[model samples]
Target: MKALVYEGARSVSVKNVPDARIERPTDVLVSVTTTNICGSDLHMYEGRAGMESGRILGHENMGEVVAIGEGVDKVRVGDMVCLPFNISCGFCRNCEAGKTAYCLTTNSDPLTAGAAYGFAGMGSHSGGQAELLNVPYGDHNCLVLPEEAQERQSDYVMLSDIFPTGWHATELAGLQPGESIVIYGAGPVGLMAALSAQLKSAAQVMVVDRHPDRLALAEEIGAIPIDDTLGSPIDQVNQLTNGAGADRGCECVGYQAHDPQGDEHPNLTLNNLVHSVRFTGGIGVVGIFLPQDPHSPDRLYREGEGEVAFDFGLHWFKGQTMGTGQCNVKAYNRLLCGLIEQGRAAPSWIVSHELPLEQAPQGYRHFDDREPGWTKVLLHPEESG
Candidate 1:
C-alpha cells in the first residue's frame, strides 16, 4: 500500500508500505476513504513534534470497514465509519467517566497514561493516511457514519477530529447561550470553534487571525474578524466588548502560534487570549503544545515552537480559568454528528480543497504555508466504495 510517510523536518512522500490488517481480536480493518491533513499533522511535518521515519502521518480519518475480528460485533464489513483521533477502550475507568482522550487502557504508552495515533509521546499506532488502517478496540473507537455518509464525507470526516475538537474547546470554556466568545487562530479548528460558538447561540462571535482569507470566512459566518497582524487582538476585543473583553476566549492555535512578523511563538496566541476575554472569563486551549522540542533552534525549518512567555500575573489577577489539552474527540462527536445530520451545523464549510490521495504532498505544502484561501484540505484515498 502507498502511504504518506514522514521523512524528517518539513518532508513527506508517498511510498509503498506494508498492508494494514486486523492485528487483534478486537481490531477492525478499514479501507480508508477520506482522511485529513490537519494542523496537528504539521507539528510532526515541521519536526516540532517527533515521529519515527516511515510513520504514516494522518489521524483524522473516515472510511468503510473492510473486515472485523471475531470479537467485533458492533461494526462490520461495509459499514461507513469515522475513527476518532483518540483511540480508547470504552470499558476503561476513564472512558466510563467520559475522558476518552486519557483512556487508561488504550493510551498507556508503556510509561504513561494515554496515547494517540500519529503523535509523539503517544502510542505507536500507525495513522490512516494510507489505503487501509487497523483499528484497535474497533467497536468503541469507530463511530458509525450516518446513512448520508456518501453524500457528506466532507462534513462527516470532520467528526473524527477538528469538528469535535473545536466544539470541545468551546465547551471547556463554558460558553453559554447569549454569551460572547473570541477564538484565536483562523485555522480549521479555530473556524470550527467559531461555528460551534454560533451553534451555541453566542451573542457575539469573534475570531482572531493574521490571515485575511480565514478572517473573511469568519466574517461569512457572522463572526467579527480581528486581524492580529494589524494590531493587538486584545485591543480589538476590548473595543468590541466595551473594554470588559469577551465573555470567553478560545486558544485554538496551540503550539504553532506566531507573532506579527511570522516568528514561531506558541505563547503569543495564549497571551492574546488572556487579554481578549473578561475578568472572570474562562479560556479553552485546543491547540497542540509540547513540553520539549528536539528540533528547535537546530532544525532548519522548525515551525511554531519557542519559549511561551505567558502573562501569569494577568491570568492570576483576573481570576480567570483555563482548560487545555488534546480534545477527547469522542466526548463531543456524537452530539455534533447528530447536529450535522440535521443540517443545523455544516462544519464542512471550512474545507477549501479536496484531492485524490496522490496529491497529498502538494496539499501539505499549501496548507503548511497557509496559502491564501486554503483553510482545510481533505484527501480521499479511494473514490466512493
Candidate 2:
C-alpha cells in the first residue's frame, strides 16, 4: 500500500508502506475514503511538533468498514463510519465520565491521559492517511454512518474532529443563546466555531483574523469579521458589544498563533481573549499546546514547553473563568453527526481542496503556507476493494 510518509520539516512524500490491518480482536479495518489534513498536522509539518519520520499523518478520518474482528459485534463490514481522532478504550474512568479524549486506557504513557492518531506526544498509534487503517475498540471508537454518508464524505468526515472540536469550544465557553461571542482565529476550527455559535443562536458572532478569505467565509455565515490587519480586535469587539466586550471568547489558534504581520507569539490569542471577552465571561481554548520540546526552534516552545507571559492579573481582575485543552472529541461527535445527517449543519463549506492521496504532500505544502482558497484539504485514498 502507498501512504504519504513524513520526510522531515515541511517535506512529505508518497511512499509505499505496508498495509494497515486489524491488529486486535476488538479492532476494525477501514478502507479510508476521505481523510483530512488538519491544522494540527501543520504543527508537525512546520517542525514545531517533532514527529517521527515515516509516521502516517492523518487523524480526521471516515470510510467504509472493510473488515472487523470477531469480537467487534456491533460494527459490521460495509458500514460507513467516522473515527474520532481520540483513541479511547471506552471502559476507562475518563471514558465512563464522557471525557473520551482523556481515556486512561489508551495512552501508554502514564503522564498523558489522551492519545491520538498521527499526533506528537499523544501515542504511537499510526494514523489513517493510507489505503487501510486499523481501528481499535471498534464498537467504542467508530461512529457508524447512514447510507447518505457515501455521498457526503467531506461533511461526515469533519465529525471526526473540527466540527465537534468547535462545538466543544463553545461548550467550554458556556455560550448561551443570544449571548455575544468572539472567536480568535479564522481557520477551519474558528469558522466552525462561528457556525456553532450561529446554530446555538449567539446574539453576535465575531471572528478575528487577518485572512480575507477566512474572514469572508465567516461573514457569509452571519459572523461579524474583525480584520486584525485593520485595527485591534479588542476595540472591534468592544465597539460591536457597545464597549462591554463580547460575552465569551474562544481560542482556536493554540501555540502557533501569531499577529497579522506573521510574527509568531505563543500568547497572542490568549491575551487577546482575556482582554476581548466581557468581564467575568467564560473562555474556551481548543488549540493545541504541547509541553517543552528542547529541540524546538521557537524560543517559547524550547525545552519541551510553549510558555507565555500572559496577563493573568487582568484576567483575575475581570473575574473571568477559563477552560483549556484538547477537545475530548467523543463527548460531542455523535450529536454533531446527527446534525450533519439532518442537514442542520454543513461544515464542508470550509473544504477548499479535495485531492487524491498522491497529492497530499502538495496539499500539505500549500496549507502550511496558508495559500488562498486552501482552507481545508480532504484526501481520498484510492479504494482497495
In candidate 2, what are the lDDT values of residues 153-197, reduced to their tens digit?
989999999999999999999999999999999999999999999
lDDT of model number 2: 0.90
> Each model's C-alpha lDDT?
0.86, 0.90
- Score every model by TM-score: 0.95, 0.97
Tens digit of per-residue lDDT, candidate 1, span 4-74: 88899888888889999888999999999999999988888887776788788889999999999999988
Question: Which stretches in model 1 have alpha-carbon errors above 4 Å?
Answer: 297-307, 383-385
Model 1 RMSD in angstroms: 2.6
Evaluate residue 36 in candidate 2 and report its C-alpha lDDT on the 0 to 100 scale: 96
Per candidate, the number of residue pairs that clash is 2, 8
Worst 10 residues of 1 by lDDT: 297-306
What TM-score does prediction 2 earn?
0.97
Poorest stretch of ten by lDDT in candidate 2: 295-304
RMSD of each: 2.6, 1.5
